[model samples]
Target: MDDNQEASSTKRLWGARFKSEPSAALKALSRSEPSFFRLAPYDLAGSRAHARELQRAGVLDANELAQLLACVDEVEHAFVAGDLHPIEADEDVHTFLERVLTQRLGPIGGKLRAGRSRNDQAANDLKLYLRDKARTLATAIGDVQAALVAQAEQHIDTLSTGFTHLQPAQPIVFAHHLMAHAQAIGRNVDRLIDWDRRSARSPLGAAALAGSAICRSPELSAAELGYDASCENSIDAVAARDHVCEFLFITSMLAVELSRLSEEVVLWSSRQFQWVVLDDGYCTGSSIMPQKKNPDIAELSRGKAGRLIGNLVSMLSALKSLPLAYNRDLAEDKSAAFDSIDTLSLVLPAMAGMIRTMRVDVDQLRRHAPLGFTLATEVADWLALSGVPFSEAHEITGALVKFCEAQDIELGALTPAMLAEVDARLTPEVLKHLTLEAAIGARTGQGGTAPARVAEQIARLKAVLDKQAAWAADYRGPRC
Candidate 1:
């Protein structure tokens, strides 16, 4: 074909409203086929919905509809088999797939676009893409959480110091400290599940920038495609990217949580702390230094969180200036989003592996865990329970701690005579609560760092995760 004929063939797929050819730079910049091909399964899902809708609207006979659907299936198979190559001439995945379908089925394939447009087509593809991604991410989060719970279960009785403002504030089981991470990850998983539900609405049939004149049933398409409902307004359907924004926001939040956990890992693995030893598989040796097992992965995971946040901010900024209906500026949406998703994909699995393989030194943890008067609060709590007012109890505990500090004595090491010197109310029974185990055990309230409470919370979280796993398995279907 000649240049003009080739251009006409490509432009014909775009519709007849344009009178002049787009500049080469504009066409080059406008391409989304490369990225869309990376998301071929999602495009195929949207194609399946569009083809069924066309068949329902009498645009194609049963045989033609079957042929078109079969062609779409062929395209997906080609993609999976590595035979499908996205062409540079194709503007986007939606256009590229339609071009391929037209080539395979001729005139019948052309009918698949009867009540569809790139506006709605792109929207639907993104929704399906996020649904699958969100579900996968939720599972990944669950895996990390499981690792955390396993660590907590193994160390439930191991005493450790819990910190507030970087200072030891109280005694807790090592398992309780680990369970806090699990709870944070569990909440992140919940966000992903909620995002999937919010993103379940189909955006099909919102042709070009408005509702199609053809009697296409988006609701039927939605049902067939496993969506909860169809979008109500075409303009808003095409213009809205809130679903994508929400997914990225949840991802950003996850990244923040991961960063916090990573920071802890980095600190714990450092020479200063020596509280844990990361697996050789998860740590790197220094180039010139003989004594370095660097927590580089943790640092990288922590650093990437800023990038995820920047991605969310960039997309929000891009959307901020755009007018109603589709705009070219919206094309900037996928890069940052795709980058953030890719970063998290790598970070989460690596972090999970790191956690699963790392070894915690209970002796070292205990040695450092009890420093800086971690049991001070327990002393105050004990005093209060023994008929002293809380304010007075706190003052007495503070003064006793100061006296112990001057004498180089731990709270547990204080003799009854020394204890009685600080307060006449001090008794043998009160000293029992001064022990780390007793202090932690005494905090049996809901959400406390007591072993029993942490165990209960873990079971509840496990049940929630088990249900999510089953739902995710069903979501993945027989392919899983």
Candidate 2:
């Protein structure tokens, strides 16, 4: 048959109840082929498993089931190789697959639709697709974390000014700052693993909002398709979209973490900071300005975070008011989710490359580490350790900083006479603790920015990353 004839044959799927054909406007408005066509492989996979269930229940005899399975495998191969595609009349992946199956098997192909509805089929296909994508995303996040850990190891002793309110607050090891981002990303991977466990249940047997009479064994299909179990309630199986929303939430959080790290990349690469230099391959130049080499990867990463957040909001809004069973509004979930998956797939690798290639300015970082009187806190600590009340010690440190600021000298530049003038408590011994090395070394407590502590933190982070890698590998094994 011609393309039009084949498409018209499929259009009769729901035509018996209607007196006339659906209007052109309704057809155009209801079409979801573009957003959901990518679910074709997953739909076919579910079909093969459902076919086994049908055969077990005597809905299709052994010979007919064999023919159905072979045809499904052919359609799946054609779809993957780009030899098959949905025509304009195909409303979604389900309709397109059914049309192809019918064309291959004649009347027997229609029998596969006996115990299911588009409602449960779409739900099953989406869960399978997202479960696979989640594994891929977790693996990509591990790449970014690996880049950060490698950089942190290289800068274990490099000193930089740690900031609060964008002003220097203290001296810190540069590795400590990089590892902080790595820690945040590790948490994002944890969220993905947790979400996968909760969403692994199959919705295949939950046909049309009520239990199916023809196909009695949802558990058989669930096991065949590698699900944890069949869903407990058919209505909840078809209507609930919390899994999609949760995936969006996880990706939104992942984007925000990348954006935070990207903002720092932008700031550090600027002339004012000079703390980092971007590799030429990862940066972009202006059309007219010869001196312009911008950190475009970082900038784009920051901008894409807003799109992820918007996708999460859109998914949540679409789900807030819908009643039980299935509704047409569920179609709105795919585009938002697909856009998030696509956005992250593009952004994650670019970020990993940018981070892996950048150069750090160790001299620049050291020069500014002690410039803002960052050793004032150390001096106060010394006074407190000497039996002075911390409140009084804070007052003494403030007075000393004020005196140095008026004289236009840094904390390290003060003389013994200057110490005596500020306070009798500020003896010559106080200057010993004022060095950048001493300041960084003093914070040797757990999770501190001290060199030894930062090294320990990196080792711990590496252990967690190794665990995350194993999880991703297992998740992508045979079931996926």
Clash pairs (backbone) in predicted model 1: none
Off by over 4 Å in 2: 1-6, 476-480
- lDDT tens string, model 2, 19-94? 8889999999988858689898899989998888888889899999999999998888888888888888888788
Query: Candidate 2: TM-score?
Result: 0.97
Best by lDDT: 2
Clashes of each: 0, 0
Q: lDDT of each prediction vs. the true structure?
A: 0.80, 0.89
Candidate 2's displacement at residue 257, Å, is: 0.6
Cα lDDT, model 1, residue 199: 70
Q: Against the true structure, what is every candidate's RMSD?
A: 2.6, 1.6
> What number of backbone clashes does candidate 2 have, counting pairs of residues 3 or more apart or in separate chains?
0
Worst 10 residues of 2 by lDDT: 1-10
lDDT of 1 at 428: 64
Task: Tell me each candidate's TM-score.
Answer: 0.94, 0.97
Model 1 stretches with alpha carbons more than 4 Å out: 1-12, 15-19, 427-429, 476-480
